[model samples]
Structure formats: structure tokens, C-alpha cells
Target: MDTEAVNNARHGLRLLLVTLLLTSIGFFIYYVYRQALPKPLPGIPCDEVAAKKVLGSLPSMFSHWKQHGVVMPWLTGHNLKHNPPLVQFFGAPFAQPTVILSDFQESQDILLRRGKECDRADRTLQSFEGMIPHHHLAMRTNGPRFKGNKELVRYLMSPKFLHEASAVQIYEKSLALIDLWSLKVKTSGGKPFPARQDIFDAALDMVSGAAFGFKDDLSITKRQLNHFLSNGVKFKEHENGSVDFHGFLFFGYIVAGHETTSSSLSWALKFIADHQTEQDKLRQALWEAFPDAAAEKRVPNVKITTTHVPYLDGIIDECMRLETSQTKITVGSWSVDDMHLFKPERWLKTGDSGELVYDS
Candidate 1:
């Protein structure tokens, strides 16, 4: 009786062990498969050659997209156009996943609506961190540090402060710029100079003062900032077990603040020059508004307020709309989200009406 009972119990124990082992094996296999599967690189070409070409083409693409919005057809071919237009590249190996975003609705969802569920895409933050430490205020979410920084910025950029700062900084700088441009004109006997330089000089001066202090001599600071922003620089270690979070704020301001604005102003001038009738109409509007030529000559002596030229303000707004300075903002994340480019029109949610919600 004892032998039979022991044998029966042993058989039962073996069966139970076999079942547990099989379950464990199944779970292990599932885990391994999940780990091995590639995360969706939204907006990235599935084809290797096309992805390579995309990385190769970014510098020119970044500039051209600002001038004339480009739809990345290769992305569509790869079934990668589901998200917004984007430009994805970093100083890393090609194995890195691409950056992507959806149209404004998605941006609103991610940035405003479902924002708590989202964070700035990881790889994009990493690239930026490598370039600009702690300067990524927008990417930091609503942390206390960011809160303090924002408060500081708000106080500094408050109406009274901005009014005074722009008076001392932008107005003076604008006069300096015109004086410099006049010198160039006189020296060259009215030969056309690339207006981009003037625009850059003006914007760089303006925003630098706006962001930092009016006293911070951004023109001198920008060169050093550029050097700091070169590719592959180390940033602070990321909180993740990964080393991706090195920061790069020092130079981020230079590029993120100035270049985009400068480009907008440059394109605005170019658009105006190319369309001389529009320019004349605007100039006449300006002349009528200012009225007194004697008083207007004091433009150099006084700050150029909004009251001085209503048409110029309208033109600036129109130019900003027609010529987007930043064509694509990159985003990469750890959640294996799809990466895609963002287009401007989709920014206003026009895609839903066109039945290209995903494709656009």
C-alpha cells in the first residue's frame, strides 16, 4: 500500500513540474520575440538605401523645406507617411531609429491634450542635449526647475521689460544694422548685397537680448555657441539606464532662437524683392502711416514701435505664415513610436478634410 501511494504521488509531482516548465518556456519565448521585434521608426524609410539617402540629404533639406515645403515621397513609399513631416538625423550610426511626429492634432494631443502620457521623444532630446545642456525647456515637461525657468523668462519678457529691452536693444541694433547696410551700399556703390546677412544680424541681436539679457553681446557669444553645438558632443547622462541625456543648452539658444527667425526675415525680404509691386504697395502704406518725413528720419534716433508702421507688422505676420522658418522638428522616443515628418498645412488640421489624415 505504501509503495503504490508513493508511486502515484511521484507521477503527480512530475506532471505538475512538466506543466510549470512548459509555461515558463512559452513565456520566455514570447519575451524574446518581443525584444527582438523592431520598434516602429515612424517616418523612417524601411528600405536601407532610402534611409541612408534621407540622412545624407538633411542639411540641404532643412534649408529647402523652410523655403518650399517638401513632402517626403520616399517615406510614403515605405509606408512611413502616417505621421507629420519630419527631418530625422543625428551624429550616430544608421541603426538609430528615426524621428517623427503627427500633424497639429497629434501635436496638440501629445503636447497639450494627452501631454502627460507623452514626453519629448528620447533620441531627439538626446541629440539636442548633446548640443545644448539644460536649454531644452520645452522638452523638460512641467518640472519644478522648468517652472522656475519659465517664471524667470516670463518676468524678463513681460510687457514692461520687453518694451524697455526692445527699446534699448532691438531699436539700437536696428539702427546699427541700417548704418552698417548703408556703409555697404556706399562702399559698393549700390550693388545688391545678400540681405540674409542683414536679417541674421538683426534677428540674432534681437533674440539674444530677448532670451538672455539685453547686455549679453550675442554676436560675440554666437561663435562660441556654434562651436559648442558641433555634432557628437557629450551631454549629461540620461535618467534612463542609458547615457542619452547629456544637455546642450548653451548653443541651443543660438540656433533655435536666432537662425530660424533670421531665415524668416531673409525669406520675407526675398519674397518682397521678388514681388516689387507688393513692396511698393507696402512702402506707400508705410509712407502714409509715418506721414512726416522730418519726423520719420528720427527712425534711427528712436525705437521703431508698432505704431510707426502698421503695414510692416502685417507684412511680417504674412511672411511668417507664408515662410515657415522651421520646416521639420525631429522627435525620437523610447516607446517605439512611429517616426514621421510634419508638414505645415497639416499644422492647421487641413488633412482631415482632404481624406489624407495619415498620408499628409
Candidate 2:
């Protein structure tokens, strides 16, 4: 009687333990599957294939980026895939999907009219805060920190400050770039050389001088140009036919501005080089605007250049539109046939006085 009772009790206890373990495993699996599933926002279109996977759109995005060296095109391509103006995609596992609003007019309206309803994303604020803790970009629009930062930097954007204090520094820095390019031309014997670093250095110099009151002698472009001129240094050509020069790097807001400005300038130069006709027209327009400077065979001053040179303005506007540095949410209208073309004339039109004027 004792042996039979003991064996039966042990078997029952073992069965109970196995049942509890199986139930726990089942609950864990369900929880993970729930987390892995895509959670799309109401009324937003999403990729069906992505919704079936744990990683969602990330795998596709990474594949596209690996092939193209960029993710924006693939991100924006969602607009073409869906008929709706708004689309959502999962950026990470178990994370909320990011909504992409492609309509330009609606996006503008939301940004301008719905400021209170739609505050800056917490993720973006946190990211910026990590890098620039006290900067306005890291704060919410309604916060005191943001308002104080705005007040501090407001004068930087003012017409008087920009035209007087900033313009002078930028003008001086630009001249250094011209001199650097001239030296490069001489050293390279009119052969093509990479100008990305030179452009970046010039941009940094301009920003540092304008923002922090740095002197011309402290400029990166000026220093590099001086080194090349004094040392009789020549550009080292690579096997790929690209030429290289020495450059230095530094790290904040200044770096951010420098990067954006340099990228735009680099794209502008590439566009201008590819379009010889537009380049010639731009040169003529500049010369016509600054007849005295052209006649003297010298570059025009900041004030003169800042004045309404329609062609120059058009070129700049076109370049910025063609290759935007920032990853913006809105997409422009697809109605225009020549939208892809780099035509500066697209931004130009005849004024009431029948003269060429800058029109966006």
C-alpha cells in the first residue's frame, strides 16, 4: 500500500510541473509575436509585406540603402507605392510606425497651423538633447528654454545683423576660397581637382567668423591656402583621377550649419559645371549686375552681390530645390514636366517693367 501511493503521488506532481512550464512558454511566445506585429496608425497606408515580418520596413530600407548609399529615395518611394498621401512604416522592432506625409501643401498647413496640436517628436528632441543639451532645437516649442534660445539668436537672423555683421565675414571667407581655387588651378595645371574639402573649410570659416567673431587669419581656408602658397605644394592625384589635399575636422550647431552649407555648395558647383550654358548665362548676369567690378577684373563686394541679381538667385534656389540637404517630410507637386532638370530659368520670370526678375 505505501509503495503504490508514493509512486502515484510523484507521477501526479511531475505532470503538474510540466503543465505549468508549457503554459508559461505559450504565454511568452504569444507576447513576443504580439510585439513583433506591425501597429499601423489609423487611416495610414503601410507595406503589407513589411507588416508580416518582425523587422517591418527596416530590412527593405537597409537593402535599398546598401545598394544606393542612401535611404531617402527608398523612404520616399512609399509615396509612389501607395495612392494615399500619408504612409507609415516600422523603423524598428516593437517600435511605433513612423508616418510619412508626402503632400506638400497639407504638410505646410500642418506645420504652420497645427503647431500646438503637433509638438516636436520626443525621439527627435531626445536625440538632439543628447548632442546639444541647452540648444533650442532640443527643447519643445512651448518651453522656456526654446523661447530664451530664440530671443538670443533672433538678432542673428535680423536684416541689420545679417547684412552688416554676417555678410562682411562671409564675403571675406569667400575671397579666401577664390584664392585657394586659383592656387589649385595653377598647381594642377588646369586639371580637375576635388573641391569638397575646400568648400567645407570655406563654409566653416564663414560660419565661425560670422557667429563667433573669428578673424580672417584664423580661418581654415586661409590657413590651408597660405600653407599651399608658401610651401609650393602640389595636389596629389589618386589612381582614380581625383586629387587630394590635407584637411582637418572639428565638432555642434556650427558643424551642422557647415555641413549643410558645404553640401549645397558642392551640389551647386557640380550642377554649374555640368550645365555650361547656364553657367555662361549666370556669369553674364553677374557681370551685368556688377559692371564696375567686372570692368576692374575683381570680385564684387558682399553688398553688391547681395543685391537683386536675378540669375544668381535663380541658380541658388534651383540648386537647393534639386538637392535638399535636410530630409524633409513633404514632397513637391509632380505636375511640372521639367522638375528633374537643373534649369535655373525655372525660377525666373519677366517683371511688370519687362525686366528679368527672380520668381520662385
Q: Which candidate is the best by lDDT?
A: 2
Candidate 1 C-alpha RMSD relative to the actual structure: 14.0
CA lDDT, every prediction? 0.52, 0.78
Worst window of 10 by summed lDDT in candidate 2:
240-249
Candidate 2 positional error at 67, Å: 6.6
Off by over 4 Å in 1: 1-48, 51-96, 99-119, 127-132, 136-139, 142-144, 208-256, 293-303, 306-309, 326-360
Candidate 1's error at 260, in angstroms? 3.7
The most accurate candidate by TM-score is: 2
The deviation in Å at residue 284 for candidate 1 is: 2.1
lDDT of 1 by residue, 2-106 (tens): 999999999999999999999999999877655443443665534344344424434544555666676454434223433325434322223455554434334
Model 2 TM-score on a 0 to 1 scale: 0.78
Model 2, C-alpha of 346: deviation from truth (Å)? 5.1
Error of 2 at 227 (Å): 4.6
TM-score of every model versus the real structure: 0.53, 0.78
lDDT tens digits, residues 11-122, model 2? Answer: 9999998999999999999999888888888778899899888899999999999999989898778778996888999888888999888755566678767878888888
